[model samples]
Target: MVIQSGESSFGRDSVTRATSPFLPPPVTHRKDCMSAAVKRYRYLRRLFKFEQMDFEFALWQMMYLFVAPQKVYRNFHYRKETKSQFARDDPAFLVLLSFWLFVSSVGFTFVLGLGVYEFCKFLLYVIFVDCIGVGLCVATVLWYVSNKYFLKPNYRGQDVEWGYAFDVHLNAFFPPLIILHVLQLFFYHGLPILHRTQVLLYPLVPLFLTFIVSLASGWNIIRTIMDFYHYRV
Candidate 1:
């Protein structure tokens, strides 16, 4: 009796619970774990089906993440209420992230004047090592820590899913990835040192190097003046 009670958990209604014997249950009758497994399986399967993914909703979520993150949370809440899970069901956001990573790598290739061999190597490292590998490690560590240390004693049959943790990391990574990796290249063009290097590498540009260098380097003098008169605040 005690063993049976220990195995049981309060149902969603909070009045009673569905339980089983100490032995394994038959496959014909699905259990709580199987339902979660099915959800995970379906989510992974959708990762390969680009046409079936909802990319428009994913882009909307990305935009709102910067403007109004609360609106995105409301959608997450709705999904949990309807689907019984907080992890995403579609893989569109991940696809978009990968797309941006590829585009950035390509831009760097020409900007750096990388050879064909170097370009291929750089592409592989950024996509696989820098992004996917780091993401997996971070997701697994946080998932274990959250489940092990944060769980309430009374909250039986409840835990954080690993997929949800990965989803969270992806959401947080998107903005910084765009700002730092994609946007910083533009600023480099306006910097004196980088502009000189660019002019040397591409002689097709009609601008004189001395004129470009003086114009670009004036920012240093402006910065020095600003530093001398530090703001009172």
Candidate 2:
């Protein structure tokens, strides 16, 4: 027998309950959907309130992503324990990521000595193509793949959340964003060994990201960088 009940999410109103041997789920499911909508509405309302966001924790997450990534994985476990959700409830990390994205782009503009027009183009590519475009495509694919093949049969009514999948992408992207876009600028002119290092580094990027840019997959970062190098030379 299934039980049916309606309770106001906004108030401590009484829940009127009824039970039947063959009650359909549509009615109860609607209440659940409405509750989720309320929570989502409240979350969006907090997005503009900077003081309410936990930027300190988000910044720690960014640093630990490189130093101790397992810690970041545990963060979700902790959230699941406390909040019953594997995805982040706060958007502070996302806000910090956007901040770093622009900061790194500005460094890239200066290090590459791009003109005003070129900088504008590069900024658009970074914002639209490199980050959002790639992130959305990768996150959607992984979300589908994980739910389709990776989920355990025992876990009913619990699959990979789309938001958690995107969070995984953000956590993974943060380190490379720092290394390639931020730290690389420091070595742009100072590194005399970069030319020699390419012979070794060229193979690493593609090899490390084979699932992403294997010869069978798509354009590889190392290959693109080499093409640019040859063009300049």
The per-model lDDT (C-alpha) reads 0.70, 0.71
How does candidate 1 fare on TM-score?
A: 0.65
RMSD values, in order shown: 15.1, 14.0
List TM-score per model, in order.
0.65, 0.67
| Candidate 2, 1-233: lDDT as tens digits | 32112212211111112223344432423423323455457667877889988777787678778777776676676455434456677888888998898899889888888888988898889878888889889999999998998888888567777778878888888899999999988877866654666576688776677755565666576888899999999
C-alpha lDDT (0 to 100) for residue 37 of candidate 1: 82
The stretch of ten residues in a row with the least summed lDDT in candidate 1 is: 6-15
lDDT of 1 by residue, 110-224 (tens): 7789988998898899888877788899999999998899888886467787888888888888888788777877764575644346556565554466457768877455666
